[model samples]
Target: MARCVLQRLLLLVITMTLPMMTMAGEVSVAVASNFTAPMKVIAQAFERDTGHKAILSFGATGQFYAQIKNGAPFTVLLAADDETPARLEREGVAVLGTRFTYATGKVVLWSKKADLVDAKGEILKTGKFDKLALANPKLAPYGAAAIQVLEKMNLTKQLGPKLVEASNIGQTFQFVSSGNAALGFVALSQVFENGKLKEGSGWVVPSNLYSPIKQDAVLLTSGKANGAAQALLQYLRSDKAKAIIVSFGYDL
Candidate 1:
């Protein structure tokens, strides 16, 4: 009788505890490389607060656009530029009326070594370094912006031979960070901490130097029926997420 009573008590405890466990769902997101660090922080908080998980894949927005078109199984896209998401919406690959600007990013002329980049970005004209890094202009919005800045200063031809091009902004940052290149153009969010550049010297490029980088996010047709996808999209616009984005040097 005692053994049977103990077994019944254990079963009752297990049954009562099961109802309190939340059934979490996953949402796959294609995130722009510039947004990677902030997205990691946001994903953790989202799962903690809502019991929903976000699976993130980070890369250049242009590459992501091609991947999505080729039938990559991504439910949400956090693009580095507004145009790509808009194009996807126009192409009918993304859900209509689901696109929104999530953040605005700035490009910066950055050097991992302190004092290498002057406040006015005079280092470019001086050409003190053997190699200057930048992303591939054809694939990254930041890279295009860097090109515009170079053009505005008439440094394109002068710096062309000395340039080291990476496929994406993240790789451009790596070039500078790893000391392979003396300096590079990277997203402000990459080198900033607590509203300032972390350990390096950088010049925050003027917005007038290039087109506005209005980063946007959209839900793909694949996510149309996914509750977790919709919820994650909504959560991105929440006050908490906004606070995190701003802290990472992105604009609302």
Candidate 2:
């Protein structure tokens, strides 16, 4: 019994230390799903130059806000919109004067095969397929854009019922990728991250179709002018990172 108790305590100590060890010289990032591809590229570059690691989590802006409110220990947040980051600062949870728009996102209707979408954007109304996927508009900005485009076309009432909802933009893209849904409304970046539409055919939603997706980033209260956080932010604005961003189909 005594030996077993000792071993158990030793295991507990090891488990607790593991996280601390991984976190040493590392920054915690709560990145919105829309920006994952470029963020990953920038994080890799930052790690190479500074000898520090970035632990990143990608999700909807609303979810990350909730987690930060609950003290999730994220040092930085790259949000799909500016409002949430501003709200966090107002709530005294994020660092004031450290928030700014990072990138502008584009939306697209994508499918695994070509010619799936028509010029009229009436694919949803036609109801010619098993499913049409989009992120939950309440949780994701791109989802909201999809709704806006539908409403502007006066097709919301007609096409609303045919929508299949995903929890985030990434999952919405996956629904189309896995053939769980016929096609999806997703950030153009996710579909373009792998270097153009090699397999899938996509409709690049016109700039006039919906509101511009001006994504923003902020330093959290958990971050200061620390070497890691500052470096990461600076690295994000570098020319190298910007090149990667454009390569992923996002407008600068």
Candidate 3:
């Protein structure tokens, strides 16, 4: 009968999907603020392709490190710098040999105004801006890189008073976008897409100006038993994730 056939079809569909439903799992991920845009896209693709969910928390790498040390339940960490993951591994908080460099970050002197920043970044020397925003160097690697750029140019002392420090690269970008500061040093990934600035103007800081911002991903001890967490870490190294990272102006 038609009714019997319909019931059988529904049962078959549920039976086929049962394995996938059981395999699907969720993982808690702590991500660096600068990687917000790309990570969102990657997380979406990861879920679509693998049936695993990533619950992301974005913040400064230093703050995340502190939280992880205090027994936060984060299953994985996507750090803005390599040191944090290495330290965590040494401290036995992270799974040994599971850390890998995910991306090399770049810094940019950026402004929301289209013509405010020149290609060569001479604006910093011109001192034309009232306030120059950056992340707190003590907690954010991007902020430390910004300080390095200033020191390399010998403008640290001269520009000291103009500095406005934010808690993280995200907040630093907010400060500039909100016009609370004229300009700020932020991750190039935050403002770039598909080989162009998404908006406003920016000067890409040269690599020689500061230490390489080698972002790394690691599985925390808390994630060792989590299949989703392990799968997510492996996914980060896949070509699809690398392409997403590259589109956002990060180097793999």
For TM-score, the strongest prediction is 3
lDDT of each residue in 157-233, candidate 2, tens digit only? 87667789999998998899999988888998888865677567787888798998988888998888555886688
Tens-digit lDDT track for model 1 on 100-179? 99999999999989989999999999998989899988999999999999999999999999999999999999999999
Q: Over 4 Å off in model 3, which ranges?
A: 1-13
Give the clashing pairs for model 3: none
Q: Choose the strongest candidate by lDDT.
A: 3
Candidate 3 or 1, higher lDDT: 3
Global Cα lDDT for candidate 3: 0.97
Compared with the true structure, all predictions reach lDDT values of 0.93, 0.85, 0.97
Q: How accurate is candidate 1 locally (lDDT)?
A: 0.93
Q: Candidate 2, which ten residues in sequence have the lowest lDDT sum?
A: 118-127
- Misplaced by over 4 Å in model 2 are 1-24, 119-122, 193-195
Off by over 4 Å in 1: 1-23
| Models ranked on TM-score | 3, 1, 2
TM-score of each candidate?
0.92, 0.86, 0.96
Q: Sort the candidates on lDDT, descending order.
A: 3, 1, 2
